[model samples]
Target: MSDIDLDSARPIFIAECRELLASMESALLRLPQEADKDRRDSVHGIFRAAHTIKGSAGIFGMEDIVSFAHAMESVLDHVRDGVLPIGDDLIALLLACADHLGQLVDSVAENQAQPDAELVHDARPLLAQLNQRLLAVRMQRSPGAGDAPQRKAPAAPRQTGADHWHISLRFGRDVLRFGMDPLSFLNYLQRLGRITTLVTLHGDVPLLDGLDPEACYLGFEVALESSAPLSAIEGTFKFVMDDCEVGILPPGSPVADHLTLMRERARGDPAELQRLRAIWLHCASVAPEALDEIAAAATKPAPAQPVPAPAAQPAAAPAPAPATVRARRTGPRPGEASTVRVDADKLDRLVDLVGELITASASATMAGRGLRSAALQEAHEALALLVQEVRDSALQLRMVKIGATFNRFHRVVYDAARDLGKDIALEISGEDTELDKSLVEKIADPLTHLVRNAMDHGIEPPALRLAAGKPAQGTIRLNAYHHSGSIVIEISDDGAGLSRERIIGRARSQRLLDPGREPSEAEVFALIFEPGFSTADAITSLSGRGVGMDVVKRNITALRGSVSLASRSGQGTTVTVRLPLTLAIINCFLIGVGGSVFVLPMDVVEECIDFIDPGANDYTELRGQVLPFIRLRRLFGVQDTPPRRQSLVVVGHGSQRFGLVVDRLLGETQTVIKPLARLFAHLRGISGSSILGSGEVALILDVAALADITRAAMVSRSPAAAAAEPVHQG
Candidate 1:
C-alpha cells in the first residue's frame, strides 16, 4: 500500500549495506585494543547485516551478487569461529572486501545489469586465500569430529541414480519460524527432482484459537524423485541443522519392504502412501547416496562423555568448556521487534500533517477569542492544548541522539594520527546530546574537517612532546552538551595550541594579511578562516590542501550557528561550535529597526532594563562594565527621533556581555522560521525570518554573528564607532 517499488529495494539495500560496512570498518579498526573473545558481538552484528542483504538478493535471483556475498560471509564465519585468528592483515583484507561488497550492492540497486568485472578480479586473490584455508581445513577432518564428514562425503558422491528422495523432517522444538524452512530446502530439492509425495503433519498444529499464524506448525514427510547430487541436497540445509533427522530412503529401496515399514509406522494411514507411490512411479528414482547424505545430516555429533557426575564428588573436573556453536539457518539477524518496511516519504507526510494540525489549532483559537458559550469556549481551549501536545510529539520523532556520529571520530582520529606518525588519543564525552535529524546530517562534514586538522597539526610528535616535558601521547577531546537552549560541541586538543606566530607568518606570506601591520593573537587565529590559509610546513594529504578549515567556518555559519577558537599557546586549543536547538521554531524578543520589526532570540537575551543614571550617558562606568553599547536606530541609519526612555537589552555569551538600545522591548513571541529569499542572501546581521499573528514577517537577529562583529569592531577601534554617540549601557 506504500506505493514503494518492490524492484527498487536494491537502493535501500545499498544504503543499509554501506552503513553496516562503516560500522564494521570502525569495529575492526578498534580490534587491536580489544580482546579477541570480546569481539564476537561485533563480528556477529556485521555477519548478520551482510547475510540479510545476500538473502534478499537471492529472492530476486541476483546470481553474481548472491555468490559474492556468500564468499565474503564465509570469511566472516571463519572469523566468527575460533579456528581462525583475527589480525591486522586479515582485518585489512576484510575492510577491502566490505568496500567491494558496497559497490556491488550499489550496482545491483541501481539496476546496472552487472558489476565491474575488475572488482571481482581484484577480490579473487583474497577470496581464493580464504577458499584455500577452507579447503585445507575441510580436507583435514570430516564433519562431526572425523566420522560426520568422511561418512557424509563418500555417500554424497555416489548418489546420482534417481531424481527423487523421500525426506521425513521433524525440526527441533526451538527452531525459529524460518529457521528450518522445510520449503526452502524442499524448493531446492525440487530444483534437482520432482516432488512425488507430500504428507503435511497437523499433529503439532494448535487449536484454531491458540495458533500463531507466523509460527510453522506443519511438518512434512516428503518423497522427491530427482537427479541432483546428494552434496547439493546436504549443503542446502548445512547452515542450520545440528541434527537433521533425515533419511535418504530414495525411490529405489525395496518397494515391499519400505511399504511394510511405512504402514507399520503410519499405523493404518494407507491412502497417503498409496498416493505417494503413484507419483513416485513417474519420476526417475533418487540417488542411493542421497539417502545416506540425508541420514548423515540428520545425525547429531556424539557427546564427548555421556555420563553424569555424582552429586557429592568432584569426579575429575571437566576440561574448559569449548566455545559452543549453535548453527541456525536464518535469512537475517532477528530485529528488536518485528517491523514492516516503510518509505521515508510517508513519514515526512505524517510530519507535515501534524504541522498543519498545529497551524489549524492556532487559527481556531484566534477565531474563537470571544465565544459566548462556556461549553464551546472550553472545547476550543482543550483542542488547542491537545494540538500543541501533538505538534511536540511529532517533532520528537525526528530527534536523534548524536552518539553514533560522535563514535566515528574514533576511527578517523586513529587512522589520521597514525598516518602522521603522531601518538594521539581521542577522548569522547556527552555523546547523549540530542539534535534535529537535519542538523545532524548537515554537521558531519564540518566536524570531520576539525577532527582531521587536530590529528594532523594540533598534536605534537611523540618525541617532541617528551622533550618538551609533556605526555608523549596527546589527547583530542570531543564533548557536546545542551547549553543556553542551544547545542554546544567542543573539539579541544591538549597538544600545542595554535602557533600564533607561525599562523601570522603563513598568512602574511600568502598575502592574506596587510603587508606590515601587526595582528593580535586572536586576529592571527581568525586569519586561519580566510580562504586558502594553512600553517603546515609541508604539503600532505591531510592538511596541506589548505582548503578545509575555511569552508568549515562558512558551513557552520550557514547552519544559523557560529564557531570560534580559544587557545593558550602551550596549553591547548578548543574549537567551540554553538548551534540552535531546532531550525523550525524559536522563541524571540521582538524589536523595531528602521520601521520594520526584527526578533532577537530570547535564550541569548540577558536582561532588559531602563537606564536613568546620568553616568550611563558616558561611554564608560556603567555598572563598572567598560564594554560600549550599539543603538539600533543609529546602527541601521534609522532617522526617527528616540523615545524619552530607551530600553537596554543585555545579551551574554560565556563571560562576555553587551547592551542593545531599542525604542521598546516587545514581549516574547513564539514563531516558526521562514527562510529569506535567495537574492537577499548576503543579509549578514539577520539570520532568518518568521511570520507574526498579523501575517507580517519579522527578521531573526543573528546574535552570535553580531557579537563577533562587535568584538572585531571594538578591537579595531574604528573611527566611525568612536564618532557615534554611546549610551554606555551594559
Candidate 2:
C-alpha cells in the first residue's frame, strides 16, 4: 500500500466519477416517469450513486467533490427514506447537481484539484436548496416524533451509553508513507457526531534504534454520540482504511466486542490491556458475567502473534450498464472470464497495427499471385483468412453500442422542453446498434443540433398540435439501424412539417433557387442544407437566422456521410443520416478509369454494365430506367481517350442511383482507407486514397457526394440535352 502510485489512480478515479455521474442523471430522469415502487427504487439508485461518489472522492482527497456530492447524497437519502417526497422541483435540482458533478470530474481530468470559481457559485445555491429541503423535512418530522404525548413509552429511558457508537482505529505502520494523515480522519469524525471518549495508544512504537520518523505507530478508541446512519459513520474513514485498521461498533454492542478490543490492544502488556478495558467500562456498564468472561480472556497467556487488522473496504463499485429497452445478462459468470479496462489510445494503436498487418497481408497475396505452386497459394489464402479475422477482432474493440450515447438525450429533451415550454417526448429505438467509437464521439454534436432543431422547430406548440387533431404532447423519434453495411440514423418529429411554399419562397429570396425555374420537391428540400438556409420567420436562441441544420449537414458530409430531409406539410419531418460502419477499412470494388485505378465502396455498387454509346447523351437506359452517368475519365480530368471496351458501374447512395464510366471493372478487394493529405482535402468526389498490394495508389470515390454531383449536373443541363435519351421506367 505504501508503494502504491496514488497519482496513477487519478485517471481511473476520474473515469469512474464520470460513469457514476451518468448513472445519477439517468436515475433522476426516471424518477419523474415512474411511480410507487419503481420511483422508490430510482431514488435509492440515485442515493447510491451520490454516496459512492462522495466516498470515492474522499479517498482521493477531492474536498470539493466530496462536499458537493455529500450535500446531494443527504437530499437523496431523505427522499429514499420517505422523509421528503420526490417532486419535479427536487428532480430538477438533482439533475443540476449531477451536471455540476460532471463538470467537477472533468476539472479533475484537467488537473485542477478544486472546482473553478464559477462552478462554486453555481453549486452554492444548489447546495443551499438541498440543505434547506433537508432541514425543512427534519423540522416537519420533529413534532410528530418528539411531541406525541399519547404515544406508548419504552420500558425505560434509553441509557446515554446505549445510544453512543464505539469506533476502533489502528494506524498501519506505513500509513504516513501512503500520504495519509491518521489525525485528519479523526478530525473528520467529529463532524459526524460528538465524541464522548477518545484515547490514543503508542504501544506499537519501536525502540529508538528501530524507529522510523515517516512510519505511523498510533491507534485510538473513541465513543461517538450521534444519530447519523451507520453508512455515514463508516464513510468518515473511507480514505484512510487502506493505510489503517478500523472497527466500528454500534451503540449497545455486546461485551464480547469490548473483550476482543482488550486482547487486540494487549500485545502481552497487562497494563495496556487494563487501560483499554477501563476505557470501555467507563463509557458503558457491563453485566458481571460479561466482565468475568472478558477478564478471563484477558488473563490467559496469549501467544505472541500480532493482532490482525480489519479488511479494508473495496474500491468503488463498477458502473451499471447503460439503461436499455430490454435487460440481458452481461459480463461473464463466475469461473468464466474477466475483463480489464485498457487506455483508449493503446487500443487505437493496436487497431493501427492491425490495419498495417492487413496491408502487409494484401501485399503478400499480391506477391503470391504469380506463384504456380498450389501449396503456396493455399498457405497465402489461409493467411489472408487469419488476417481478416484479426482485423475484425481489433475493429470490434472500437465498436460500442449507441445506447449510452442515446441515453444522454433524455436529459437534453427534458431540459429543452422545459426551456421552450413545449411538451415533447423523445422516443429512441435501435439503441443497441453499434458503430465505431470514434464515429460515436464525432457525431454527438451534430446529433445534438438535430435533436434541438426538431424539438424547437419540428415539434409544434401543444395548443397547435391539439387543434390539428394530434396529441397535445408532441413526439420526436431517434431511430438507428444498419442498412447496406452502413448505419442509418433518423430524427423524426410529429409536428407541422416543412412548408414547401415557405421554403421555396425563402430560397428565391436568398437566390438559392433559379430566378424563374421551379425545382422538384426533392431539390427544394435539399436547399435547406445550403449555408444560411432556413424558413424560420423569426429569430430565437434555438433557431432562426438559418444556422444549425446547415452545420449538421456539413459535419455529416465531412465524415464521408450523407444527410437528406423528407417532410409533408402539416404532417411531419424526418432527417435521415447515413454513415459507414467503420472509417479505418472497408470492402471496395476496384475499377480502372483510363490509366488510373479507383475504389468504390462495395455496399453502394449495384452492378456493372456495358457502356453502350447513347449518341451525345450522358444518360443511358438501364433496366427500363433512365440512369444518369458520370464518366470518371472526364470528371477526374484524365488526359486519355476512352477505352474501346468500357463499363458503367451503377452505384446507389440512399435513394439516388448513378453510374461511373471506367475502362474496366477490377472486382472486389479489402481497402484500407488512408485519409487524403491536407492539400487534397478540398478535392471533390474523392474521399480518401488507398495503397494497393501491387504498390499502386487507388483513390476511394465518395459515392454519396458523386451521386449528388451527378444529380446536380442533370438538373442544370438543358431540357433538350436531358431528353436526348428517352426517359423510361418499369
Candidate 3:
C-alpha cells in the first residue's frame, strides 16, 4: 500500500479530538445534576469519547495521546461499569485529565510528535492517581488483589478456555484510494491483543494484467488471543468500519458458528465456501468433527418450535449481534443530514468573492440606469436581486450559533467558583442566537473577562447572600438575542449590584468626575470601564487588577459595537453589548451631505423627514419628544453650500433615537464595508468606508459613536438642555 500522508490528516484528528474533549468536559461538569438514567448515559458517553480519542490517536501513531487516553478510558470504564462511584473529587480529576488531553492535542496541532518533557512530567502524578483508583477498586472486588508483591503483577486475561477472538476483515476496494493502509489497522489492533493465527485470502484478486495498484483486494482472518472485551476489539476498526467489513466473534464460540460465518462470507459459492472452511480448519486450528456436527444440525431440522419472546429469554443467553452488522444493515436514519468541514479561510474567500460580485452588480445597475433602456434596466434589476441572494447565502455560511461559545464558560465558571469559595451557578438562555463566526472568535476574550469579573467582583459569598434573604447560590445569567439587525448579549449577576455611592466616590477621587457635580447613575456606572478604575476593597487574582474591563470595552468598540450598563444598587448589574450581525457586507441607506456620501445601516434607519428648523443647533422637538441631531456638514467639515431643502434621517440605536441631517436623502443599497486606513482610524462618527456604484467612496456612519457624540455635545451646550433630553433606558 502507498504511504498515507499523515500530515494531511493531523488537522482533522486534532479538530475531532478537541470536539470530543469538549463534550467530555461538559458531561463531567453536569454529571452530578443529571437524573439516574441520564447519569448512566452520560458516563457511557464520556467513556466512548475517550475510547474514540485513543483509537484515532493510535491510527495516527500519536502514542503519547493514545497512552494517556487509554489510562483515562480505563478509569472511565470502571465508572461506566458501576465499579467506581461518581463524586466531586472524581469529576475534578477527570476534568484535569480532559484538560491535559487537550494540551496534548494542541501539541500535536503544533506539529510535535509527542508531548513536551514538561507535559510528560505533568502526566506522571495524574497517571499514578488513576492507577491507584483502579487498584483500589480491584482490591475491593478481590480480597487478595492488592498484596504488595502481587500488585505489580499484570492483569490476568478473562477466563475463556482458549482466550482467542476471531476477527474477519474484508476491506473495500477504495480504502487505499482514501489514504488508508490495511496494515496500519492491523498494526494498531496488535496493541489490544496478540494475533496467534492469520490467513490472507486472495480469491477476490484479479489477474496480474488486470490488477489496479490503488485497489485493495486482500482480506484477513485473524485469531487474536486477547483479554480485552468484544467492544474494545471492535473499536480498533472504528474509523474504517464504514468502508470495511468487520466480523468479530468472542473467544470460545462453537465450531458451527465458524461454519455459519464462512457460509455468509462465501455467499453460496461452493468453491469459495470450501476454501474458507479449509483455512478455518487448518490455519485457525478448528477441529474437523465440528463440520459434521454443523452438517447434521443443518440437515436434521424437522421439529416445530414456537419462538420465545425477547423478554422471556434467560439472563445467561448469548449476547445480541455486534454493532458492525447492525450498522451496515441499518445505514443512516431517515432525514439525517450529512456535513462537510471546510476551512474558515475558504469561507472568507467565498465571502470576499461575493462582495466583489455585489460591487460589480451595483456598477452594472448604475450603467443600465444611465442608458434608460427598459430591457437593460429589467435585466439588471433581476441580476441585482440574484446578487443580493448570493450575498446573503455567502454571509450565512459564516454565521454560527453562539451556543458553542457560551457552553465553554461552564468550565470557566466551575473552575473560578472553586477557586473563589463561592456558590455560583451560570444560567444561559437564547444560546441558539447566531452571529458572524469572526465575531464569535474575537468576542470570546471580552466575554471571558466579563464572566470572570462578574464572578469575582459581582457575586457575593454564600453567607452574605443568605443574610440578604437570597438563595445561598448566586447566579450569573448569560442571555443573547437579535434586535434591529444586531446581536445583543447580556451578562448579569444576582449579587450586590454596583455600589452607586462608592462608584461616585471613586470617580471623584480619581478625578474622572466633577467633585461638586452629581452625575446620573448611568454616568457613574460608566466610569468603571475607564482605564485603571476599580472599586474592590482588596485585590484578587481574578478581578481587582482593574485591567480587563477597559480592554473589553475597547475590543467591543473596535468591532463596531456598543456596551452599556444598568444596575439596581442592591439588586444586580447587567451589562448589555450590541454588535452588528456581520462585519463584511451590510444593507445601508445612502445619503449625501455637501457632496459627501454617507451610509447608514438599513436596520438602524427608522424614517426620513424634511429637515425642519434648519437653524436648530443640535437638538430639536419631534412629535412632542426632544430629538437630538448631528449635522454632517459640521461634523466632517464638508465645504459646500446647504441645499434649499435638506432632510433629517431618524436612526434608533438601542433605546436612543437620533437624527442625521443631510443635504439629500438617497435611497437604500447593499454596501460592502471596507476598513479605513490607519491614517483615518481615529476619526469619530465613522466606522468604515464603502465604494458606491459611481466609484465614489462613501463613509459608513457609526451610529453608536454618533449617539455618544450627540449626548456629550448636548451636555456641553447646557445642563438645562441635557435635563430636557429624554432619558434612554438602555
**Which candidate has the highest TM-score of all?**
3
lDDT per model vs. reference: 0.65, 0.78, 0.81
| lDDT of model 1, residue 15 | 66
- Model 1, range 551-572, lDDT digits (tens) per residue? 9999998888888888877778
Instruction: Give lDDT: candidate 1, residue 596.
Output: 73
Query: For model 3, what is the alpha-carbon lDDT of residue 318?
Result: 57
* TM-score of each predicted structure versus truth: 0.70, 0.76, 0.82
Lowest summed lDDT over 10 consecutive residues: which window, candidate 3? 148-157
- Candidate 3 differs from the real structure by a C-alpha RMSD in angstroms, to one decimal, of 6.9
Arranged by lDDT with the best first, the candidates are: 3, 2, 1
For residue 660, model 1's alpha carbon misses the true position, in angstroms, by 2.5
Instruction: State the lDDT of candidate 2 residue by residue for 569-641, as single tens digits.
Output: 8889999999999988887899998888999888998888888878667787787777888988878899977
Candidate 1 residue runs with Cα over 4 Å from true position: 1-5, 8-16, 108-384, 470-472, 515-518, 611-628, 717-730
What TM-score quantifies how close candidate 3 is to the native fold?
Answer: 0.82
Q: Tell me, by lDDT, which candidate is best.
A: 3
Compared with the true structure, the alpha-carbon lDDT of candidate 3 equals 0.81
Which pairs of residues collide in candidate 3? none
